[model samples]
Target: MPSRHPAEVGYGHVVESYVTRTYGGLPRCLVLNGGRFLGLRWWHTTRFTLHLLNDAAAITDEELEALLGYEWRSRLTAAWLIGVDRRERFRARIGALLLASEVCYSGSAYCFALARFGTHADAEILAAYLDHYLPRTDLHYDQPAALGALLRLDAVLGTHHSDRFTEPDGLWDQWVKGVGRLGYPSYIPTEQRRWADVQCEFANDWSRP
Candidate 1:
């Protein structure tokens, strides 16, 4: 694996401090940080920062715009954090990024986030991603996250396409198997497991009404 970025390391420490002081619990902080623990991996820290921003109760448009300008991960997370309530200001940018073929894991993250907080059109965008984009990509670690996103989308919309890309077993279960077949262990971080559990709960609730 490549070395962690200095900024990522610093961000990890900062997030750890926040968890220790502000949240008073690592679990809460990790949830807000999108299942990232106190690690120095650049991608993990990046996701954590985006989740932190997303959980913030209030963010000025200027602050969000600055975040949107930071990097692809930041931009996608910002788009998700902004949610449907503030869709008008950032929808075009998010759409453009989603359509950009060069955007990678962040794009997948955006798809997951959008499915939860986006409009119908955004859901269509995610369906397009599932139908067209995901198959062509050579995803490794993030495949489960993307699969989880699709599962969430299916849960909400009652449309089933997760099995189309994964195994016949089930959503999360099959993704774990698929990842194992790809030579990666099916070990999700503790925080992500919690997140996945919550998604499963939410899916169940949505299926009710």
Candidate 2:
């Protein structure tokens, strides 16, 4: 809300600088009792989460608009703000981002944002994402999350948009079943855990003498 904030910001800095400038107590992460860093994501820390929530509350349309569709961190933060506030104006942008799937982990956030908007349009967006990405068994993207969001929205809006995808041995079924067949994907680009991938990764880690 302050005019003192810069008109533009760069990768990683956009959300961080905005929150730090607008609110003073933002931490890069929250150190838990186990000595693991909570990391600056989602609502993990009360102080920092409050900072993000407050920042989202005060972010002007201009700031919000600037934050979306840029760096992953900024984009994720922007999606969170839009979803939390139910900013329906940015629904299309979120849907576009979901379809683009360019931001990797950003899909879940986008899906959640659409669900928050809670309209048939939102369900349509989720369905559209599934329709586009569900077939690529070779690529395990956010199909599960997107479909889950669609089902959630369907429940709320009384729409059966998810039925076609969820039918027996359909695309969704193939995806779930085929993942294990990809026993060792040459690349785990998204770092999303796949069928039996945890042990493989763990074996790699353990084998490292």
Candidate 3:
């Protein structure tokens, strides 16, 4: 989708400057600049950029042609690149992707990062992930990247639910154990540990707004 705001394109130039200075090279800056304006196109451009950035070795048999192709990669990278300062601009689409059942496990970290902003939509996604995906015995326990996604999900959910969710003693333990079974890191800060607990309590509510 083209940006409703014309200035958003201009702001893309500003981001180019920032990314250029931050990366200490002009080539990466240009790529990032394309990414920002690509937000105007939004889905396709972002997906292509991410595919180029993350991997170029060879296409995979498991890749989803309709949804999981280059476009999805761009959206994922857009989520990956969005800093705390620029989150509001991409929040809606990112939130939509997270709640969709079609969202890939490989893109989980992007969703987890979005949750750090703690929007209600993000909270909803975390609740859904906890309730639906985390409990299956055949859960993709061997994927370490999935664990990063879970940790970020846990971190954000923990921040929100730490107070009320902690009333029960064993609630958090079951969660930690579940994630730990997958070989994820065990130590979440007391302040940032509640998502693990709440994921244990989620009841498969995937309803999104």
Candidate 4:
């Protein structure tokens, strides 16, 4: 059954409908009267989609589960956005994320999000699942994004690799070494990454792209 709360149900429908209409298909753009092509910012997309995921707790378990396994990057992006931005907001819905391990990009989104919100215990949950997925791959895995997310989480939690980060010595160490191999250069700091002044150029690029 759908959620009985009108606000919750309405928000859920709004997001579900939007995803159905536009998630993975052709990008949305338009032409201005000045004859300029305009498109949406990745930040806008991430934020809007995140609004839906922020409401994840209100949706039924079934609806939440359905979203977990969605194939498109948009859906996974939504999940990761929630993981990073609204991790505390959806604390109750995390089990669904963990169960979504089989979905293509879902694991990365889920793992990173959990890392962000998970308590010491929650971190343990993520660490348990660490071995199954690798750091980087051409199509799906993004080491920079994942490690970036984890580092951000660590900062938020105010704890270092004390309890949760430990993995079997050789395997986890090898993955860390592999990540180092990628020469993952740091981008702008987190505050810089999101600010209007620093991001204005990329925002303009999105509008033009």
Best by TM-score: 2
Which one is best on lDDT? 2
Q: Please give, for residues 33-92, the per-residue lDDT of candidate 1 as tens digits.
A: 453333345345444444444454355555555544445445544554554234455655
CA deviation > 4 Å runs, candidate 2: 1-13, 18-45, 183-209
lDDT value, candidate 3, whole model: 0.38
Off by over 4 Å in 1: 1-57, 76-80, 84-92, 98-109, 161-163, 166-182, 186-209
What TM-score do all the candidates reach, one by one? 0.50, 0.69, 0.38, 0.45
Q: Select the stronger candidate by TM-score from 1 and 3.
A: 1
- Model 4 C-alpha lDDT per residue in residues 72-140, reported as the tens digit of each score: 343454454454343455554653455434444444455455555647655445444443444332123
| Tens-digit lDDT string for candidate 3 (1-209) | 22222123332232222222332233433444333323334434444344433332222212212122233333343443442222445555554555553434324434434544545555555555445544453443212322333454546456443323233543344555676787866534343434322322221221111
List clashing residue pairs in candidate 2: none
Clashes of each: 0, 0, 4, 0
What C-alpha lDDT do the candidate models reach, one value each?
Answer: 0.47, 0.60, 0.38, 0.40
- Model 4 pairs whose backbones collide: none
State the displacement of the C-alpha of residue 127, model 1, in Å, after optimal TM-score superposition.
2.5
Candidate 4 is scored at a TM of 0.45
**Model 3, residue pairs in steric clash:** 46-74, 47-74, 158-194, 158-195
